[model samples]
Target: NPLMQPNAIEKISYGIDEAVKATGLGRTFLYERMASGELKSIKVGGRRLIRVADLMDFLQNAANQRIS
Candidate 1:
C-alpha cells in the first residue's frame, strides 16, 4: 500500500498525539497510564514522548495479561 509505504523511516519516540493515533488509545487514557506508571514516558523540553520499544512492550504486556 502506497499510503503505508510513504513513511519508511520508523519513529523512535512519539509525542502524545502521535502515540494516541498509533495506538488507537484515548488521550486521557494514555495520560492515566503514564501517571500510574503502567506506560512509561519522558518529557523533553516540555514535550512528553514515549519510546517505540516501550509502547510495544506495554501492548505486549497488556495482551499477556488478557491471556492469563
Candidate 2:
C-alpha cells in the first residue's frame, strides 16, 4: 500500500494535505514546523505549497539531527 500511494511528482510542489500524508505528521505539527521554520513553504496567490526538494531536504536534515 505504501508503494501504491501517489507522490504527486507531476508538480514541483504539494499542498498542505499532501504534505501531511507524505510526512505522516499531524496537521497541527506540520503547521507548527512551518511556523518555526523547520519546514519551508511558499504561498502562491492564496494557497501554500511545499517544494519537493524542500521536503527531501527536511527529511534529510531530520535524519541528520537524529544521527547527531
Candidate 3:
C-alpha cells in the first residue's frame, strides 16, 4: 500500500512536445499537418495544444485511408 503508485491521470490535451513524444512523429511533420489542416490544434496563450480526441481521430482516419 505505501509503495503502491497512484493511477496516472489521462491527458485531455498535449502541447507540441508532448504530442511528439506520444506519437513518435517529428515536430516538423506535426506542424506541417497542422498547417495543412490535416491535424487540428488550438492556440492557448502562447502554447499550441492538440486534443487527444482530435489526435485519435486523425490517426484513425489515416488508418482508414490506408485500408481503402
Candidate 4:
C-alpha cells in the first residue's frame, strides 16, 4: 500500500523539525548524530532534506544494533 501513499517527491524536502517529529528524536540528539556523521542529510537552499529512504535506512541500521 506504500504506492498508494503520496510520493516523496511531492513532499519536496524534509526538514529537521519534520524528521524530529517523524522519529520522535530530540533536537539535540538528532543534531549530535548529524554532527558526528552518523546520519546523512541533504541541503537544499536553506533547508535540510532527509529522504524517506535515508531515514528508513537509518532506522533499520539502528534497529539492527543490540542494546544489552
Candidate 5:
C-alpha cells in the first residue's frame, strides 16, 4: 500500500534532502524557508517532507517573475 500510495496525488511526500537539492538551496537556507512557511512541508512520523507538485509550482512561479 505504501508503494501504491505514492502514485496518487494525495499521497505524495518528499524527503528534506531531496527537497533541498530540488530547490538548489543550502541546509540553513532550506530550513529558514521552511520556518518562514515560504516553502510548504508536511510532518510524517517525526520527519518533514515536501510535495513534489508544490515544489514544481514554486519553480514555475520563480521562472515567471520578470526582471526589473
Candidate 6:
C-alpha cells in the first residue's frame, strides 16, 4: 500500500538536500525562496523540510507562469 499512493502525496516532507535534488535547483536558490516566503517549509527540530505537496504546487505554478 505504501507504493500505491501518488508521489505527490507519498512523501510528507523532504530535507533541503533532498528538496534541491527533487527540484533540480541549487541549495542557495531553495534557501532564498524559503527566506522570501515564496515556498513553504516546516522546521522539524533544527532541520527545515519542504512539504511534498508544496513542492509540487510550486513546480506547477512555475510551469503555468512560463505558459502565461
Task: Give all TM-scores, in the order shown.
Answer: 0.87, 0.80, 0.87, 0.73, 0.64, 0.81
Weakest 10 consecutive residues of candidate 3 by summed lDDT: 1-10
Give one digit per residue, the lDDT tens place, for model 3 in 1-68.
Answer: 32464676768999999999999999999999999999999999999999999999999999999999
Which runs in model 1 stand beyond 4 Å of their true positions? Answer: 1-7
lDDT of 1 by residue, 3-64 (tens): 77996776899999999999999999999999999999999999999999999999999999
Which portions of model 5 miss their true places by more than 4 Å? Answer: 1-11, 66-68
**Candidate 4 lDDT trough over 10 residues, lowest sum:** 5-14
Candidate 2 residue-wise lDDT, 1-68, digit = tens: 53676774466788999988888978898788899999999999999999988988988999999999
Ordered by lDDT, highest first, the candidates read 1, 3, 2, 6, 4, 5
Residue 30 miss distance in model 6 (angstroms): 0.5
Best by lDDT: 1
Model 4 over residues 1-68: C-alpha lDDT tens digits?
A: 45787663455446899988988988888778878877878888888778777777777888888553
Task: Please report, in order, the local distance difference test score of every candidate based on alpha carbons.
Answer: 0.95, 0.88, 0.94, 0.78, 0.73, 0.87
Residue 45, model 6: Cα distance from true site in angstroms: 0.7
TM-score, predicted candidate 6 vs. hidden true structure: 0.81
Candidate 2 residue pairs in backbone clash: none
Q: Compose the digit string of candidate 5's lDDT tens values, residues 7-62.
A: 75553657888777666877787678779877777888898888888777766766
Better of 1 and 4 by lDDT: 1
Q: Model 4, which residues run further than 4 Å from truth?
A: 1-13
Q: Clash number for every model?
A: 0, 0, 0, 0, 0, 0
Tell me how far candidate 3 lies from the true structure as C-alpha RMSD in angstroms. 3.5
